[model samples]
Target chain A: MASFPVILFEGGDVPDSLAYRAGKLGAEAYPNVEFLDVAGPRILMAPISCLGAGFAPDFHGFIEYRATDQGCPLTQVMVDAVAAGGLCLSACTASLLACDPVQVFCATVLRLAPSIDAMMVELALAEAVGNAVIHGNLGLKSDLRHSLAGLVEFNGRIAEQLRDPTLAARRVQMTALPYGDNGVEIQVSDDGDGFDVEHELGKPLEVGAKSGRGLALIRKVSTHIEGGRGGRTLVMRFLPAG
Target chain B: MDIFTDSHSDGTRFTLKGVMSFRDRDAFSVILDAVNQRAGAKVTVDLTALEHVDSFGIGLFLLANEQAVGVGSSLHLLNPQGDVSRIFDLANLDAILSLKQTMPATGATARNSAPPRRIGIDYRHLGKAEDGSPCVGFSGRLVFAEHGHFQEIVENLIANGGPRVVLDLSELEFMDSAGLSMIMIAHEEAEAKQIALVLRNPKGAVAQLLSLSALEFMLEA
Candidate 1:
C-alpha cells in the first residue's frame, strides 16, 4: 500500500479540519516548519500566501491550503516545488513552450506519484496544459477547431499571438502535490481571461462535436475535477488503483 | 519562421529564416504539402538564413524528408550556418537527413510565403490493406497540436483514396479530445465523399479515449 505523509509548515497550530482529514486518510501529520524524523516520502502543507520557505530535504512535495487558490504565481509554484524537492514547470514564452511541456510534466509527475496510472495522468495533464496555452494564454476559441479553415485560422492566430511579447510572456504553470494516502492533485493555472465553467460543463457532449471534449475527457479520467480562480485554474485529483 | 519559396518547373527551393521551432509548424506543413504535391522533384530547404531550431523543429525536417521519400522524391537541406549547423552536427542528423553545403544554380522560378503549424504525430502511406484499400499508418500522440497535420492527411486521403482508406492507429501511443474531434471530422468528410475512412487498432490511451468519448464505434470494421 502507498503512503503520503504531511508536514504543516505554517509554523502554527494545525487546523482541525486538516488534521482530521490527514488522520482519516491514514497519514501522519507533523506540525510547524521545524525538522522532524518522518519516515519516507512526505509532503508539506503550506498556506498559499506563504513565500520562500526554507528548503526541507525530507519533504518530496508541497500542497497549498485550499486547492481552489488560483492566485499562486508560477514563480512561487517553482519556489515551492524546488523547496519541497519535487517538480514544477512554468512556460512564460509561448514560443519556447510551444513544445510538449505536458510530456515533461507527465514524466516528472509519474516519478512523484508512482502508484497512479501514468497514461491517465498524461491525457488529463495534456488537456489541462493544452487548455492553458491555447484557450487561456492565447485566447483561442474552440469553435475555431471544427474545420480545416478554422484550424488554419487557429494556427495563424497562435503564430500571431506568439509574436506579441505581452501575450507570449503569459505563463502556464502546472504543479503536482501529494493528495491523501495514495493520490495526487494537479493544479494548472493560466494567465488569461477565464471561461464560464458552469456553462461549459453544463453543455451536453455531442459525438460529432468537434470542440468541447477537453473538459469531458478530463472529468472522465480524473477522480474529481473543479474550477477555481474564475475558471483560470483547474484542479484535478487522481487516486491510485485499490 | 519565414519560409521564402522559389518554385521552378522541376522542384522548389525553400529559404528558411529566423527560428524554426514548434511555432513554425504550419509553415513546415506547407513545405511538406509542397513536397507531397510535386513527386519526383528535388526539394531543397535552404537553411542559410535559419539561425536556430528546437528538437521539434529538427523533427519537422526529418518528417519532411520522410514525406518526400513517400512520394518518390528526395529532400536536400542546404547551407546550415551557426548554431543550426553545430546542433545538426551534434545530433548527427547529417547521417539521417541529406545535407548539402551548396545551393543549386538559380533558375526561372515563382516566389511565395506562408504561415506555420506543428505536429507531434506522424503518418505514412502504407500501401494497401487486405481489401485492396489504400492504408495510411498514423503513429505517436495525435493531440491538438497535430490538428492541422491531421486535416492535411484527411484532405490527401479524400483527394487520392479509392473507395476506402484505412487509417492504421495501432502504433499510436496517445491522443487527446481534440484528436478525437479531428477523427470525427475525417469520418464525416469520408462519408460525405463516399469513401470509407476505416480506423484500425487504437490501443492504450488512444483506445480508452475513443471508448470514453463514445467514439469506439469509429474503430469498428
Candidate 2:
C-alpha cells in the first residue's frame, strides 16, 4: 500500500497487470495512464494517476509518486490530503500537482478557503537523480506507501467512529494541490506539520530510514514507480486515474 | 412545535413530530430536569416526523445525552432522516449515540437532536470552479487559495467566540483546503475567542474527512 496516494490523475498510462492487481487489492486501480501539464511540471503518467479513484471511511490520506519535476507537487499532494482529512505523507517531492481541484476529493469538506496557487515551473531538473533513486531501483516501495496510507486513513476513521459514535455521521471533502516548484516552504509551521517526516532526525535526514520497507513498497507498485528526488523540485501533474 | 415524549422506568423514548430548533432549548431544559429525577433508564429518541434539525438541535441532543448518561442512562436515536441524520453525522454523534434506522424498543433518549424552532435557516447555493470542475455553493466543495486567510479565519473566530462552535458540513458535497482551513480557523478563533465551534451533522464524504484530519475533537465544543 502506498503511503500518500495521489488524489488526481496528472496523466499517464497504467500497465494492464497493475490495474488488475490493484482491483484485486480492494482498491480502484487503473491500467491505462495519460500525460498532462495540469500543474507545476509535466511528465509521463502511470498507474493510480487519477483523482477520486480510491477513498476510505475517513475520506483522507492518499498516495502519489513522480519521477521528475522535483518534489514540489509531491508535497502538495500530501498537503491537500492532510487538509481534507488532517493527514498526508509523500516519498519524493517530484509528483503531479496541476489538475482540476474539483476532480480530486478533499479528505475533509469545509467552506472557508485561502486561494489557489497559480505559479508553474515549465522546466525539468535533476533528471539522473529522479530516474535512479525514485523510478529505478526502488519505485514500488513508494507506491505501496501511498496505497497503504489510504488504508490507514480508512482504518483511523473506523476507530474514531467507535470512540465517538456521533463522529460516524460527519462529512468528508477530498482535494489535491500541485506544489509550486520549490514548494512555498511551510517552515516554522505547527508541530504536526512534520508528522510523515521524522522531525526528530534534525532538519534533513538523508535517504530517510531503512530502505527495506520502502523497497518492498516499490516492488508492489513497481510499474508506476520512479526512483530518486530531483534536487531542484518535486512538483508535477498527477494522473489520478491511470 | 409540540414535542412528544415517552418516559418509562427503563427507558425514555421521545418522538419529535414537528420543527425542532434553538427556540425550544428552554422547554427541553425544563423537561430534562423532571426526567433526570427518574433516571437510570435508557433514553431513545425517534425523529421520524421531525421536519428539520439545526446546529442547536445537535447541541440539544448532546446535552440530553450527557444529562441522561450522568444519571446512568444512555441516549439512542431511531429512524432519523437526511436533514436530522446529517446534523448528527457532522457532530460525529452517530458513533457516540445509538443511531438506528429503526427505533429500538428500549433506551433513554430525549429527542434533543430535533431543533426547538425553525427560523427559516434554509438558504442553499451551488457553484462550480473556473475549470468546469463541478462544485456546489455553500455546501459545495471549498477551495482556498492562500494560507494567510486561513490563519485569519481562526483569529476572527477567536474574537467572536471561544473556539467553541460546530460547523454543519453534512450538506456540503465538495470542499477544498481553503474551505477546510476556514473551519479550522473558525475553530481556532473559537478557542482564542473563547467561543464554542464544532462541526455538526456531517455525513458521507464530509465526516470521513473531518475524522481523518483528527479535527473532530478539536472542532467540538
Candidate 2, TM-score vs. the true structure? 0.29
Which digits, one per residue and each the tens of the lDDT, describe model 2 over residues A121-214?
Answer: 1001111122222223222122221222332343343344324422221111122232333222111111111122222112432222111222
Q: At residue B218, what lDDT does model 2 achieve? A: 48
Worst 10 residues of 2 chain A by lDDT: A118-127
In candidate 2, position A89 carries an lDDT of: 26
Worst 10 residues of 1 chain B by lDDT: B107-116
Tens-place lDDT digits, model 1, residues B76-103 = 9998765566557646998999998775
- Candidate 1 local lDDT, A1-242, one digit each (tens): 33444444455666666566556655555665444566645555553223121122344444444333333322445445444545555545353244454654575687778899988998999898888878998888888777666777777887898788778767777778778777888988888999877688888988778888889888888999999889998989999977
Q: How does model 1 score by TM-score? A: 0.60
Give chain A TM for each model in order.
0.67, 0.20
In order, candidate lDDTs are 0.70, 0.36
All models, RMSD in angstroms? 13.9, 20.1
Off by over 4 Å in 2: A1-242, B7-11, B103-221
